[model samples]
Target: MLKKQFKTTRVFRFKRFARKSYSVFNSLHKTVTIGVLSGCALISAHATTVEPAERVYTQTSTDSIPPTELDEVVVTASKVDLPLNLAAKQVTVISRQEIERAPVRSIEDLLNYVAGVDILQRGPHGVQADISLRGGSFDQTAILLNGVNLTNPHTGHYSFDIPINLSDIERIEIVQGPSSLVFGASAFSGGVNIITRKDPESNGFAKLEGGMYGLFGAEARGAYKTENSLHSLSAGYKHSDGYIANSDYNIVNLLWQSRFDINGSNLDVMAGLNDKKQGANTFYSAAHPNQFDDTQGIFASIRGETGGRLKFIPHIYWSRHYDEFQLYRDGTPDIPATYKGHNYHRSDVFGMNLNMQYASRWGITSFGGEFRNEGIMSNVLGKPMDDTIGKYTKSDSRTNISYFLEHNFIFNRFTLSVGGLLNYNTAVVDKFNLYPALNASYRPSKSLKLYASWNKATRMPTFTDLYYTTSTHTGNSNLEAETSEAFETGLKYIHPVIKGSIAAFYMKGRNMIDWVKTSSDALWESRNHTKINTKGLDATLGLDLKEWFGANQPFHSFSMGFMVLDQNMVESGLISNYVLNPLHYKFTAALHHDVLKNLSLSWNFRWQEREGSYVQYVDSQPGERVDFTPFSLLDVKASYRFPHVDLFVNANNIFNTTHVDFGNIPQPGFWLSGGASIRF
Candidate 1:
């Protein structure tokens, strides 16, 4: 039996922004204050922000899918979601079916194909990857889980330490631009939101896999349904001996989700955990080949909506992350005298947000606010502590309060939206700052739309950037927040036979943060660099051959994307760890075709040229600087479908190409993997 979603209903609405009547405004204000403080969860009517979006990617052993409708897809970066056709920002989506058919395994790998998004991996299989958007550094993007911020206060490098199993993801959506005016700080460059919605059509699935380097794994997911409630569970564990010495990893993930109907409102609750242990050879510094890392993350959240004309959405979440890193392996033959004890850190985040909307003849007005507290306890990253918890002996904490209000006006084929976020952070001097945004879209025809956007954003320094101390690196607690003002313009065309989009963006940044050293002999220090300006362009085109010509066409679909980026920064005899090694040029292409009725093949090709250079470290010491080298990779996947079972085989880096994504870190070569799954 398949379960269906339950929705609430709104029968009335006022025309203004909470000022229908003075008394009503006061009552609503009191209600909202209580909701935000007491951690209440609410959901709008039938269709609210982030409505369930289930998309199909292929036609193997299943009925054919209908063509995509532009108006049917919505962007949820704001309190009031808008259709993609009328949106001023561009969003890239990776559907569940696409993930199932891709040659990639980890979420990090899947994001590599995106044009402006970069995933620099320190280890394979989602062990540790730094995610960046546009030409910004990894920490500039806001990482979210089901719309709840999951960013780590310790460092952005651990932002991908998600607790949910890979199989539990419903979709991954990327908004490739600053959303500080929309989703608040750390979305300075972009936002990546992972949604794990329950699938009523799927009773459950189980799978097993094995590959190179003695890799093996098993995973299972199940969904149960009742009249007014649904429950889901997912769990997975994998381990390998590693492709090289000390590169092995073991990972375990577990997640559970439940939803219930309370009167005319909807209630959602979820919890998950992810534990990973891996060798971090050359992950941070290449000076030691025996470096290792272990991390455990736990998170839980609740959200829902309740209201009549004034739709209110309340969200509350909590997450804790524990991380331990070793500069030298525990069993190292000889430890350097400069090597201090291992680094141990713990980060905790608790947050609550209240969003409300009112629709009237005047347009749609949305207002919301969020309260968040992020704290870290670390041996090497924060201020000294009076007491110790386990191995941690230092601590620091900060609170951020953000409020937002926006008005959306739609006149025929034209749409305009203006909003801003009033933000105040305890770590940033406790002063309020306003980040304003303006978005407009014009549709001259049914197939073509032009959009433009302008916004300002800022991101706070992480614990590691603030107070970390070591032999090779030192932090600055006086470092100011990084800020940027960006502008973007783009055009998109949608058709049954062909779909294409082109966009260009420019950003002026101030107080940019980076770890730099005057020379190899000096310790790396975190500093706020001078003004840096960035500009970039990206274009994509896709063709559906089967729809354009006939069903007998040899190829089912083909798509390609290209991107170019430029940034200006120069200093005499200065060495930078990040910000310099960005993608200068990137190209990606994918092709899918049906070899047989039940057999399908997908081919993926990517080429990228990186900028800047990295210093080579040897034997626990910094050596000479090495220039980056460009690399190309090809991957392939084949899938065969049966009545109730699906079998797949994939090969990554099939041509045995050697590459380096970060400083002195060598990437894997050719690898082959296969898997089988049974679906009920």
Candidate 2:
């Protein structure tokens, strides 16, 4: 309820994007808008009745309309504020209720149930995981916190290294497609934004959890609110002896957030810090069973919106990630000195943006520019350094500039939006490139809506991909930036008893990057392929059993989802590492029911078929080539309600089905955990 009331995007208008240099960028921005609109031409469609220009632009946005059954949930679509039904792209909203009731312990696990999103986990309990959307690799997706970019510059493996506990989240918004125009080049496949809680009343909670394998965890959160401001603080710690030999982990998280209202506008500030010491046995190479890593990260951002008839937003964000990865843990009696030391890295990212928008007789016009700097200092990840800093001797840095222009139009039952992005990266390209987008939606009735969108996005290789080198691996500094042109069309149906959406999409990628080698024994090198095309179908259906069966409803909710993807790449003899292999088929189902007056249960199940193979290890050596096989997983949770607390227990991988999500990494089986929440 607080999330629905004090939505940051709606109230503060601290939207994602904005530009500087009005006079210089204005002409070029308008020309791009004209070019895209002319190329798209208006087609037949229907939508909600357009409100009068003056009232619609000012009133519909400033005032909050109570959401109905979560169907009309407000979500940010392509950097524009729009309700779910009005959005042109496929967007998924995971509400606070869903997070509280779900049978998952971490944010990464909850996202695995979504239709188009993918979470490839090497270890559980927030140790490490790679997130992707649609059929793209983990590196192609952009992860944000509170609309701020916190993704790592060294590698996608650290993108999920967020510094906050799952209890600190309020809601999550996922846009499943290319959104580079707003989130930048990394959003080639999609983007996910985690919004933190903003409580209006004074409240707090403390939780404790424990399970098998010597697992133990504790967390606490508190929030205080004044008439014009709100502040919150949360901290947590978790440890596990692991389900297998050398798979243990220890993690600590701390988070702080605040909001202040000044005049008619508002300001929001948040920061987080987390530390991790993990046993990553066989995580990267199957030959090493004693692999270990230590990670420390900090992310902070401040955003403020202030304006009258025209809105202006100023934002500043920064992140620092430090990692020490050991192929073999200390004191392992290595064979050579080259293999005796650990790899150390430090990445820093700083960004700032200024945005302006206006609403008048014409549709809303928004324009903004961003300046970003990404730099890395490491022992083995960048160019050779002439001077040393601390223990790092190598370094690299790049500057990126991006300008955005977007407009939304409403005419009776038709809604349309056109936008374009201009970007320049000093590390990859010499000049700015144009990435254009067009989206439209039609609503023939209250229950059914049709939408279509076409978008383009590009991604530059990370520091790891550009300079990493070793005896068994090599990096190609000449690799070109990859690009994708995507088109999607979908229909959403919302009814009292049945609510669902189905979409079909296609993407054409050029100059795709992949780790390849001529044969199994050759060194792995990064290379760019000519073209790769992908097509997929994603659908989800939810049934409100309560509405159908009245008080005797068999279950409170039931949902099922299916996704199939096929990718065709240029035929070659290259042995691919990341790009070629992906999930070809995936299906998910969920059921939640009340067993008694105070007891409830939830069942979650999924089946996946992947298209790839890995060199299986035997007796500490690569023995057999094993192709990926289909696997199924089932998870269930039981909860009992009390006056001020809830008791819950969950079993993941209940069937103990052996499966492989990433190369040479064996997933846990039949794990159980329990916890209790106390509120005050």
Error of 1 at 649 (Å): 0.7
Model 2, global lDDT: 0.76
Best by lDDT: 1
* Per-residue C-alpha lDDT of model 2 across residues 191-267, encoded as one tens digit per residue: 88887776554279899999989889999999988888889999999999988878999999999888776643556
Candidate 1 TM-score over all chains jointly: 0.91
Off by over 4 Å in 1: 1-49, 52-70, 570-573, 618-621
Count the clashes in each prediction.
5, 8
Displacement of residue 63 (Cα, Å) in model 2 is 16
Q: Tell me the lDDT of model 1 at 111.
A: 85
Q: What's the C-alpha lDDT at position 345 in model 2? A: 100
lDDT of 2 at 210: 94
- Please give me the total number of clashing residue pairs in predicted model 1: 5
* lDDT tens digits by residue: candidate 1, 409-518: 65557777888888899987749999998888888987898989988999999898999778778999999999999999999898879989999999888888888888
Error of 1 at 614 (Å): 0.7
